[model samples]
Target chain A: MSDNPQNKVKIEARDVQVFYGEAQALHGIDLDLNANEVTALIGPSGCGKSTFLRCINRMNDVIDGCRVAGTITIDGQDVYSPEIDVVELRARVGMVFQKPNPFPKSIYDNVAYGPRIHGLAQSREQLDHIVESSLKRAGLWAEVRDRLSASGTSLSGGQQQRLCIARAIAVSPDVVLMDEPCSALDPIATAVIEELMEELRKDYTIVIVTHSMQQAARISQRTAYFHLGNVVEHGATQQIFTNPKNQQTEAYISGKIG
Target chain B: MTEPSNPSARKAQLAKRYRAERRFRAYGIAAISTAGLILFFLMGSILLSSLPAFTQHYVTLDIDITERHVDTQDLANSDWRALARNALRAQFPEVSGRKEKRALGKLLSIGSSDDVRDYVTANPSSLGTSIRLPLTLSDDIDLLLKGVIDRDLPENERVVSNQDLAWLDRLLDEDRISRQFATRIFTNGDSREPELAGLRGALVGSLWTLLVTLLASFPLGVMAAIYLEEIAPKNRLTQIIEVNINNLAAVPSIVFGLLGLAVFINFFGMPRSAPLVGGLVLALMTLPRIIIPTRAAFAAIPPSIREAAMGVGASRLQVIMHHVLPLAMPGILTGTIIGLAQAAGETAPLLMIGMMAFIVDLPTDVTAKATVLPAQIYMWANNPERAFMARTSAGIVVLLSLLLMVNATAIYFRKRFEKRW
Candidate 1:
C-alpha cells in the first residue's frame, strides 16, 4: 500500500466548471486524487460533491442539460476528449451509487454482469473465479455463497449494498467512485463497509462522497471539505479533523451548521 | 364505552361510519350486478338469435342423368341442374302447373346445382344412374325446418307459400329432410345464401391482416419508442414528435382509413380488399397505439437501473436491449395484444379500404381478395335475408370469443414473466 503522502496522481482536475443549462454549479475547481488512496469528498447537500465525483467517469453526460468544462484526466487522457469513449472510461472507473441498485437477477449473475460485459474472463471457470474473488473482496462471499442462485433483490439492504460493490469490482477497475455508499445502511453495516473500503484501496484508487464526518475521518487517507461549490480545506484526514484552517470546516465539525 | 366520557357521541359516530361503509358496499354490488345482468342479456340474445346458423337442414334426393340430358361425347359440359329439376319433378307427379313446379324448384338452394355437379364429377361412372345425394335446402326451407317461419300463422302471413309449405311438410314426413351440424358455415366463405357461407374466409383474412400488422408495427413502434425515450435529446423537434404521436392516437380511426386510401391505394396502386393493403393501413394506425404503451413501459423503469447497466460499461443500446427492454417486455406485449385485438375488430378502416367487397373465396395469400371478420359481420348485418341476421349474430360470437382468447393470453403473459423487482 502507498502510505506516503506523495503517491502518484491517478486523476487530476484543473479549472473544472460544471453548468446545468445557464446555471453554473461548480466554479473553477482544481483537485488531484492520488493512487491507491481513499480520498473522501465531504460537503453539505447541493455543494457539488457528487457532481465532482461524477466528472471523473463522465457519468454527468447522462444528465439532460449538464455540461462540464475543463480538463479532467485519468491515466493522462482527458476524459472529455473527443476520442474518449465514455463506455470504456466507465469500465476503468466503476461507481457504487448511494442506493444499492442490483440488477433484477440472481446473485451470481449480478456479480458476473461487469465481467461478462467487459469480456474480462475467458471461460466459465474464469468467470466463476472472478465472481468468487469479487464477492470475497466485498466481504459477502461466505454469507451468500450457498444462495448464488437466489435473487439479488431478495438479499437484505446491507447485503445488497455489498453486492453492488462486488459488481463494480468484478471488472477489475483501477478506480472506484462511491457516492454515500453507506448512507442507506445501518451503523453496523456502515462500519462493515468502512472496513471494506480500507481493504479495497490496496488495489483501487477510491473516491467517496459522504455526509458522515466520522466515516471520512476513519476510512479515508485524505479528506477535502467543500462548502458552496468550493473546496474550503483539504489535507490529511487527521490534520483536517484536529487542525482546521477554514471557519466553515470548523463550524461543520462542531455541528453548528451543515 | 365504559372508559369514554362521551360514550353516546362515540357510539353514534361509529354507527354513522358503519352506515356509510354499508352504503358504499351496496353501491359497488349494485353496479357490478347491473353490468353483469346487461352482459348476460346480450349473450343470451345473441345465442337465441344465432342458434339456427349453427345447424342446417338438407334434402336427400335421387336424380338421374340420361344420354339426352348429358352428352357422353362432352361429359365436361354437363347440365346437372336441369337433370336434378327433372328428376325432382318426376318424383312428385301431382305438381302439374308450371308455377307450382317453379315453387318446388325454389325449395332447392341456388348452390344445389353445384352440389349436383360436384357429385357427378366425383362419381363419373354413375352419371346415368339415379344417385341418392344430399343437397342443401333453400334458406326459406331451412328457416321453416328451424320453426322460425311460424307454421301456425296463416299461410299468407308467412314467408313460405302454402304450395311449397305442403311440399316441405311432405318431404319432412317422408324423412327426406335431416339436420346436420353447420359445417358449411365454418368451412365456406361469405355467400348470398347463408347456408353456403362460412367463417373460414374471415378468419384467414383476420389472421393474415394481423400477422402483417404485427410484423410491421411491433419492431417499428418499439424502436421508435426506444429512440425517443432512451436516446433522443429533449428538444423542440422531439417534443413536436411526441405531441404528434399522442395526437395520432386520439384521431378518429376512420381518418386513418382515408389516409390509407389516399396513400396506399391511390398513390401506391395497391389492390383493394387485399389483406396485404388492409394490413398496411391497420399497421399505420396501430403504430401509435403500440408506441405510447412501449414508451410508458420504458418510463416505468427507475433511472437507477439504466445507471447501473451503464455503470458496468454497457453502451446505451446494450443497456436498453439487455436490461430495460427485457424488463419492459411484458407491458409491451400487453399493449401489443390490445392493438392487435383492436385491429381484429376494426371495420371502418377496412370498409374504407374496400375490404367490404363480397368475397366468397378463401385467400391463400395476403394479396388475395379477403374480408376481415368485422367486415364480414358488417356485410352480413346489411343483408336483407333473415338467415343473414342469424349469421351476423354468430359472427359476433366468433369475434368476441377471439377477443376473449387474446385477453386471456395477455393475462397469461403478465403472470408468466412479470418482474417483481
Candidate 2:
C-alpha cells in the first residue's frame, strides 16, 4: 500500500471477499475512496461490481446466505465491528440502488424519512429545511419545489433518482454509494444524474458502480474495472480508459472482453 | 390466394372452433350459476321457513290492583311469592268462587310470579296502583296461532290437545287474546318456551364477544404478521412458524372450539357461557385467519421500497413502520374483517364453549351467561312451538346481513388502499 499523505481517504476496503453460499461473488479486493472525489466501479454483468458496492454499506446482510469478509472502514471506524450500530453505520454511509425506489409516500415524506427516524430534525421547519437543502443539492428543488406533497413515484424516472439522492443526503451521510444509478433512465435523465454526481462530489465522497464506460469517463475522477470478481485495473479515469496498464483493461475498453 | 381454393373448408373449421368455444363458455357459466343457485336456495328456504316467528299472539288484561291485592306490608317484608299470587288472583276476580278461580289459575303460567316479583321489585312505588300487564300466551296458544297445532290430526300424532286449541280459538274471537307483531322477539331473552324467546339477549352477547375478539386479535395478529414477514430472519425456525400458521388457518374451526373448551372453559375454570370466555376462544380461532392474510399483504410489498428506505439511511424498523405497514394496511384490514366474519358465523366452536346455555335474561356484562346469534338460531330451531321457526329465520336474516356488511367493508378497504407499487 502506498502512503499518500495528501489524499484524504474516507473509506478503505482491504482484502475484501464476498460469497453467496458456496458461490464466490467477489474475490479479495482492495480499494480506497478519497474525500470529495468520485470513484466509479465499472464492469460487465456478474462481475461483482454491484456486490462490492453493497458490501461497503453492509446491504448484503439482508441477502440470505450472503457473507462478506475482511475489513471495511469509514474514517478509521470499522463498519463491521461488533459494537457498531448498523443503523448508525448506515446513517453515515448511505446508498442509492439501481432503480429509483421512492417510498410509497409523498415526496416530502420520502426525503424527510431519514432525518425523522434518526431524530436529526427537532421541528417540522427544520425537517423542511433539510428536505429543501437536500433536494437543492441534488439539483431537483427547481423542478419539484411546487409539488413537494405529491407522491415521490409521480416524478419522472430521472427525477425519482434525484429524489432518492436527496433522500440519501438528507441524513447528512459522509459517503454516498450508488449502484448503476442511471441504468433505468433515459439519455437526458442519465446526463442529468451524471451532472448531479459531479456536483455532489464537492460536499460528499461518492462511489458509483456503472455499466456505462462513457459515464465513468464523463463524471468519475478515479475508476476501477472489475472482471470475473477481480479488480483488473484501477487508476485515474482518463489513464485507465486511454492507457490502461493491464491487457484485460485494454481489451475491455476496446470492446474485446466484457 | 392459396386459401381461396378451400374457403368453404376453412370457414367450416372456424365455425366449429367457435361452437366449441361457445360451449366451453356456457359450461363455465353453468358451473358458476349452479353454485350461486344452491346458495340462494339455501338462504331462501331459511328465510321462508322462519317468517312466522316474527308474529306472536298474546292475552291482554286490565287488572285492578287495590291496596289489599298487592300487599305492601308483605312486599316490604320481602314476601314476594305471596304478593305475586295475590296479584294473579285479583286479575282473575274469581278467587271468591273457588272453582272458577282454580280454572283461571290453571290457565296462568306457573312462573308468572317471577315476572310479578321482578316488576314489583323494579318499581316498588307501583305496589298499590292499578297497572295493565300483557302476559305471554301459553306455548299451546302460540302454536295454534301459528297454525302448527292440527286439531284434525290423530290423537297420537297431535302434540297440542284439541281442548287447548278450542280454548285458544274462542279466546281469539272474543278479542281477549289477539295476534300481534312479536317485537318482543327482538327485545327479550331466551327461554325454555320458544314462544317467549327473542334474539335481543343473543345479539348483545354476540356484540360483546366480537368486541373482545376484535380488540384482542387485530393488533396481535397484525404485529405478528409484520414481524414474521418483514423483520424475522429467514431460517428453519421462521419456516416452521410460517408452516404452522398456514396449517392453523386450515384447521377445522370446531377443533379450535374443542381447544377452547379444554383450555379456556375447563382448565382455566372461566365462567361457563360468558362472552369473555367465548370471545377469547373465537379470537384464538380467528388469529391464524387474520395472520395469514396480513403476512401475505406484507409480503406483497416489493423489496424495492425497503431497499429505498435503507438506502436513505433509515433503520429496518423505520422502513416497516413508515412504508411497509401503510402499504399493507388495506390487506390487513380486509383480512381482519374477513376473520371477524368467519368468527361471527362460527357456531361449533361457540357451542363447545357453552354458548348453548339456556340464558333466560339479557347479559349485563361479559361474564354473564350469554348466547350468540348462531347458538340462538340453533336453540330456536329445536323449539316445540311452530312460531319460533319464523323468529329463527329472522335471526338468520340479521346474521346474514351483518356478515354482508363486514364483507362489504372488507372489499371497500381493499379497494381504497390498493397500491400500484
Cα RMSD to the true fold for all candidates: 3.1, 4.5
lDDT of 2 by residue, B284-399 (tens): 98899899999988888889988887776667777788888889899899999999998988889888878987787888888988989999888888876666677778889989
Model 2 reaches an interface RMSD of: 1.4
What tens digits encode model 1's per-residue C-alpha lDDT throughout A191-252? 89999999999899999999998888899988888887788888788888888888889999
| Model 1 per-residue lDDT tens digits across residues B94-166 | 9988888898888888777777887777778886688887777899889988988887889878888887878
Tens-place lDDT digits, model 2, residues A32-139: 888888899988789999999998888988898999889898999888889888888789888888999988688998889889989999998999899999999999
Q: Give me the displacement of residue A120 in model 1, in angstroms.
A: 1.8
How many clashes show up per model?
Answer: 1, 4
CA lDDT of each candidate? 0.89, 0.82
C-alpha TM-score for every candidate: 0.92, 0.85
Which 10-residue window in model 1 chain A sums to the lowest lDDT?
Answer: A1-10
Off by over 4 Å in 2: A1-7, A254-258, B1-17, B58-68, B71-180, B415-420
